[model samples]
Structure formats: structure tokens, C-alpha cells
Target: MKFILASASERRIELLSRVIKDFKVIPSDFDEQTIKFNGSVPEYVMKLSKAKAEAVSSATYAFSESDVTVIGCDTIVSIDNLILGKPKDKQDAFRMIKMLSGKVHSVYTGITIINVNFDIIKCDYACTKVKFSNLSNQDIEKYLCLEEYEDKAGAYGIQGYAGVFVEAIEGCFYNVVGLPLNKLNKMFGEMGINL
Candidate 1:
């Protein structure tokens, strides 16, 4: 199968590389804010993932080979229903980090797989709880200097320097990183793509 990943996330790329060795990266251009869901966070994530997969799948329909599977993923960090997307700037990043300090938040990663030619589709999500340490202004400033918060949902990368700020985590650790490796692998297996 010709596998296509519908994201440019470095973390997602790295996590997927563990199971699938060769694949094409075609970032999805779907605007997420356009989507409004009245359901739970999991439902919202699934909708976004499906939209991303469908967007890329439809756009490249005529160009795909006989066996092609496109994967789309989206991650969100939330505290009591307040969703935290990627930070806008330095101040935004700082604000997000400070809010997450000393509290546990939920990280949700939605994954969608679709075979345009065969009409096969799947959508699911994984949630992990992450607790951040009580950070001082100096601590936040020091971590912000690393500048790894721009593309992360929670203004922090668990695999980067922010790892030290994580007090505890429940559920899949990879979910906090971006993509849930276990969930992704399981989806691939269910689709009959052994790897």
C-alpha cells in the first residue's frame, strides 16, 4: 500500500516511523476552526481527523495508486473543557504554560485512516492525562526560551526540555507527544496492513 500521512508534525512523523518505514507526507490543508462540534472532545477530535483524511483523500483521488491509505491525526490539550491549541506567540505560549502549571490536563489525539479506492475507513482517539509541576516565572521563562511551544497543543513538548516539568502522566505517554503510537499501530493492523 502507498501510505500517506496527512500532517507535517515532526513528532507524528517520528512516532509513525516506528511502525511504517516508507510513506509520503502530504500535510492536510483543512482549516480546523471551521469545524464546530456539540459533542465531547473525543467526538470533536474524531471529526477533525476524519475531515483531514477526507480532504487529502479527495484532493489526491486521481493521483493515487491502486492500494493507497491516508492517515490523518489531530491532537488537543484541554483543562475542564477549555481546549488549548498551538500558541500564537511568545505571550500566548507563556499563558498556556502558566495555566497548565500545577494542574492535570487531558491530551487527546485523534487518528483516521481511509482507503479511497476500497471505501475503507476508520476513526478513533486516545486520551492521556498529564500533570504539570508548579512552575515559577523563572521556570516558565527558561523553558519558553527553548522555543519548542509554537507547534505543540499544550505549549510544551513532553519529549523535549518540558519533560522535566511533567509531574505525572496517566495513559499512553506517546499521546502527549503528539501521535499515539499504540493507537496508530492498532488502526493499521485492523486495516489488514500487518505493520
Candidate 2:
């Protein structure tokens, strides 16, 4: 069987490598802006992930005949009712971090797995509670200098320099990193596939 990942994220690629060593990285053409938040973070992410997987699966179907499993994932950070995605600029990154300062936020990662041969699609989400310590302007400024916020949801990556900002996390650390291995294994098990 062939494995494909439907994302361009380096983080997702690295994380997925921990389980499946050989897989194709085929970033999906699905535009995230096409999906609107509908009050539920989990549902929103799941939909995004599914769209991503479908986009890649359809494209791959036309070129390959072998059995394939395509995985797609999406992550977002939420505080109160606001959803925080990747920052648009330095100012935007500062704003997101400022809002998360000294607050507990929820990081939601939605994962979708598609079995192309069987035409089966399964999707699920993992939520991890992350508490960030209070950040002064200096801290935010110093962090911004590192420029780790680029292309990362919540304007921060828990596995990077931003790790210092996080005081605690209540669920899968891998989820915050962009994929949830345990949840992923369970989802695969549901489909009678190991790994």
C-alpha cells in the first residue's frame, strides 16, 4: 500500500515520519479560506482536513492504481470564541501571542484518513489544553525576533522556542505539534489497519 500526506507543513511531515517512514508528500490544493467557522472548532477543523484529503485523493486517483492511504490534518488554537490561525505579519503574530498570554487556550487538530481503494474516509479530532504563562512585551518581542511564528498556527509552535511560553498541556503533545499519533492509530484501527 502507498501512503500519502496531504499537507505542505514541514511539522506535519516530520511528525508523521515518526510512524510511517515512507510516504508521499502531496500538499492539497484545498483553500482553507473556503471554509467558514461554524462555532464548533472540532467540526471546523475536521471539515478542513477532509477537504484537504479529498483534494489529494481525487488527484492521486487519476494517476495511480495501487491501494493508497491519504492523510490530511488541520490545526487551530482557540481562546474564548476566537480562532487563531497562522499570523499574517509581525503585528498579527504579536497580537495572537498577546491574546494568549497568561491564558489557557485549546489547540485542536483534525485528522482525516482516506483509503482510496476502498473509498473509505475517516476523520477525527484531538484537543489539547495549553496554558501559556504571562508574556511581557519584551518576551513577545524577543520571540518575534526568532521568527518561529511563520506558517504555524496560533502564531506559535509548542515544540519550538514557544515551548517556553507554555506552562502546561493537558493532552497529546503531538497534536499541538500538528498530528496526534495515538488518535491516528485508533482511527486506523477502526478501519482494520495497523499503523
Candidate 3:
């Protein structure tokens, strides 16, 4: 059996490596924009994750493989019912960071694992509340200059320079980093994957 990760996120790969010995990454090619938000963050992420897992799990090679399990994950930042995804540009990054400044936001991460041959399909999510320290415009500007906000939701990464901005986290810290490793590990254990 081959373990596969249907995501292109480096953070997920890095986090997963801490438990699993090895796995293949087959990034899901689904266009996320196809699914519009329906006012439910959990539903949005879970559906997206399921789509990604099934996309890779349905591949011919996946069926040919002794039994391939594909893992899919998706994360987003929400504050006051507004879902913030990757920033479109530097300006957008500044805007996102500014809005997130000193505010409490929720980070949601959805995890999906599927192996059609074994009739295995798992979907779950973790939500973490993160409170950011009030950031000055200069601080936001400097962080944006680092350009780490380009591909990050909320225009800040808790594992990067932006870590200083986080004053508190009420739930799983890893969830804010894009994938909740602790939660994933527990789920993997339940699935008999000894991760």
C-alpha cells in the first residue's frame, strides 16, 4: 500500500513527515474558486478537502497501486464571518494583516483521507482561535516586505516572523500553521495507520 498526500502545501508535508516515514505528494489540481462559500467555514473546507482527496484517489495509477490512500487538507482564516484566503498581492496582504491586527480570528483546517479500494474515507476538521497582538503599520509593512504572506491565508504565518504577532492561541497551534499535526496523528492512529 502506498500513502499519498493530495496537497502541495510544504507545511503539511513538513508536519506529516514528523510522524510518517515517507509519502508521495500528488497536488490536487481542482480550482478552489469553483466552490463558492456558503457561509459555513467547516463545510467549505471539508468539501474542498474531499474533492481533492477524491481527485487523486480516482487516478488510474492510484487504483493500480497495491492500495493507495490519499490525504487532502485545506485551511482558511475567518474573522467576523469573513473568510480570508491567500492574499492576491502586497496590497491585499497589507489589508488582510491590517484587518487581522489585534483581532481574534479562527483558523480552520480540514483533513480528508481516502482509499477507494478499501472503502476508506475519512473527513474531519479542527478550529483554532488565535489572537494577534496589536500591530503597528510599520510592523505590518516590514512583515509584508518579507513576502512570506504571498501564499499564506490571513497574510501571516504563525511559524514565521509573524509568530511574534500572535499573542495567544486557544486551540491546536498546528491548525493555524495550515495542518493540525496532533489531530491528524490521532486520526491516523484511529485509521490503523500508526502515524
Candidate 4:
């Protein structure tokens, strides 16, 4: 069987490399804007992950003769039930970072695995509570200059300079980085796929 990752995230790719040595990266073409948030962050991420996995799986299924497993993932930060996705611009990024300063928020990552040949599909999510230290406007401005917030949810990347912003985390640390390795390994084990 072959393994494929339906995402182009460098963090996720690096994380997954710790478990699986060989896999292909096939970024999904699914447009996340098409999905609306319906008050459930976990479900929302799961839906997006599933759509991404299905998009890649369907696009490649016909071409491969062997079985292929496609893994898709999505991450988001939520505070007060409000979802914070990638910032549209610098000001938006600053606004998101400011809101998270000195506050506790939840980081959610949804994972989906699909084996088209076996007709198997699995979806799950992981959430981590993160507390940020108080940040002055100067600190926020300085961090924004690094441009690390551009493509990251909540206008921050826990694995980047934003790591200093996190005072505490209540759940899986890897989840905050994007992919929950423990949950992912367990999911693969449950599906009888040895990584």
C-alpha cells in the first residue's frame, strides 16, 4: 500500500516524518471557504479534513492500481467559540494576536484518513488548551514583522516565534503545532495500518 498526505503544510510534513518514513505529498485542492462554521469547532475541522482527503483520494484513485491511503488534516484556533483562521492581511493578523494575548484559547486539529481501495474512512479531532502571556502592543508589532503569522491560524505558529507567547498548554503539544502524532498513530493502529 502507498501513503499520501493531502496537505502542503511544512509543519505537518515534518511531524509526520517522525512516524512514517515514506509518503507522498499531494496538496488538496478543496476550497475551505465553501464550508461554513456551524458552532462546532471540532465538527467543522473534521468536515474540512474529510473534504480534503476525499478530494485527493478521488483525484488519484483512478490512476493507481495499488491501494493508497490518503491523510488530510486541518487546524484552527478558537476563542469564545470564535474561529480564527489564516489572516487576510497584516492588520487582521495583528487583531487576532491581540485577542489571544493573555487569554486562554483552544487549538483544534482535525484528521481524516481514507483508503479508497478498501472503502474505509476515518475522521477525528484533537483539541489543546493554550494560554498566552500578556503581550504589549510593541511585542505584537515586533512579532508581526517576522511574517510568521501569514499562513498560520490565530495569526501565530506555536512552533515558531509564537512559542514564546504560550505560557501553558493543557493538552497535546503536537496538536498545537498542527498534527497530533499520538492520536494519529492510534488512528492508524485502529485501522490495522502499521506505520
Q: In lDDT terms, which candidate is top?
A: 4
Put down candidate 1 lDDT per residue, 39-102, tens digits, no spaces: 5899999999999999988877778477788999999998988888899998999999999999
lDDT over C-alpha atoms for residue 158 of model 3: 95
Q: Total clashes, candidate 2?
A: 0
lDDT of all predictions:
0.90, 0.94, 0.88, 0.95
User: Over the stretch 116-187, how does candidate 4's per-residue lDDT look in tens digits?
Assistant: 899899999999999999999999999999999999999999989999999999999999999999999999
Q: Candidates' TM-scores?
A: 0.96, 0.98, 0.95, 0.98
> Candidate 4 deviates by what RMSD?
0.7
Clash pairs, candidate 2, are none
Shift in Å, residue 58, candidate 4: 0.0
**C-alpha RMSD by candidate, in order:** 1.2, 0.7, 1.3, 0.7
Q: Candidate 2 local accuracy as lDDT?
A: 0.94
Query: For residue 153, what is the lDDT in candidate 3?
Result: 88
Model 3 Cα lDDT, one tens digit per residue, 1-195: 678888888998998887777788889898899989999999998998888888888873635777777889999999999999999999999999999899999999989988667878989999999999999999999898899998898888899999999998999988988889888888777888776
- For lDDT, candidate 1 versus 4, the one ahead is 4
Give lDDT for model 4: 0.95
